[model samples]
Target: MMTFKFARPLAWLLLAFIIFVTVSPIGERPNTVTMVDVDRAVAYLLLGFAFALAYPKQWKMVAMLLIVGAFAIEYLQYFSPTRHPRLHDAGIKAMGAALGLLAGWVINRWRETKAPNGLPFAER
Candidate 1:
């Protein structure tokens, strides 16, 4: 089996992409599905996945960072002239983060199970 290593530069690029999608005004217009909310949620989810992929052993840290990042962004919005953060938006973000973390845990657990000499479900 191939040993997969996380590429530091690629990870940084992904982080930059997440930040751009999170704060950019390119999708500020009102529309069905609410592009801003969707993008924010997706960004959070992707961020969680990225962190998990890069540091599979640091799942708790990933979760903490996601929650803190969401809260910080919401707080920042209060001072932004163009944006006022909504409680509902924060709730949506939190839910997205939770779902993303859960997905990451599931994928990681599955990978561990399939690894050579990994403990079987009954043993674990």
Candidate 2:
């Protein structure tokens, strides 16, 4: 399957961002103008997507790590003076990560099915 040259590096960058965001004070966080839940979900979604693409052969492990990392993010927030951790929030993040992983799976499947003759898999 075709893979992006920088997928792994991007994933690492995202992981670092996630940690930074979690630890930073609430007032320091960027204003996305969206609901906090939406922000949390989308962040984890992107993180999972990167990891999935970075490690195409390890999607299952990526799913597990991302989910665990979601909960871990919440747990980390508890140590932050201005942040609070919530199970509901973690759940949302986990769901988003799952969706992201599914997206990566779809992309990989599509690329793998590309025909040798430069046509769609079905046309081959």
Candidate 3:
């Protein structure tokens, strides 16, 4: 991730943003043209992608965190007076994360095939 050195930190920032948007007052949420489900899917997709790219060796842990965190974070919405939470939404988010994880894994494998030593400059 030399070309994207900030992936790890950025993943954390995205998680923070997700938490804020999930539990904050409805009025504090930003408006978007896409459907609400689509928004959640995309947000978690990127979150999973970032985490996968950042910790390529920890796919199992990352998968657990992103998938479980989806439901865990959604549960937080139950406590918000202005926000409504649904299992459907959590499922969408989890699926999106799973797709993202799959994509990242594909990319990681491709990179490994192209660079056997895990370095662009290393002799094949």
Best by lDDT: 3
TM-score of 1: 0.70
- Alpha-carbon local distance difference test for all models: 0.64, 0.82, 0.85
Name model 2 segments beyond 4 Å from true. 115-124
TM-score of each: 0.70, 0.87, 0.89
Instruction: Compose the digit string of candidate 3's lDDT tens values, residues 1-124.
Output: 4324787898899999999999999999989659988998999989988888778878789999899999999999989999899999999999989988888777776776777465642122
Model 3, global lDDT: 0.85
- Per-residue lDDT tens digits of candidate 1, residues 14-45? 66665544454535623436576786687667
Clashes of each: 0, 0, 0
Clashing pairs in 1: none
**Candidate 3 lowest-lDDT run of ten:** 115-124
Flag regions of model 3 displaced more than 4 Å.
1-3, 116-124
Clashing pairs in 2: none
Q: What C-alpha RMSD separates each model from the true structure?
A: 4.7, 4.0, 3.2
Q: Residue 14 in model 3: shift from native, Å?
A: 0.6
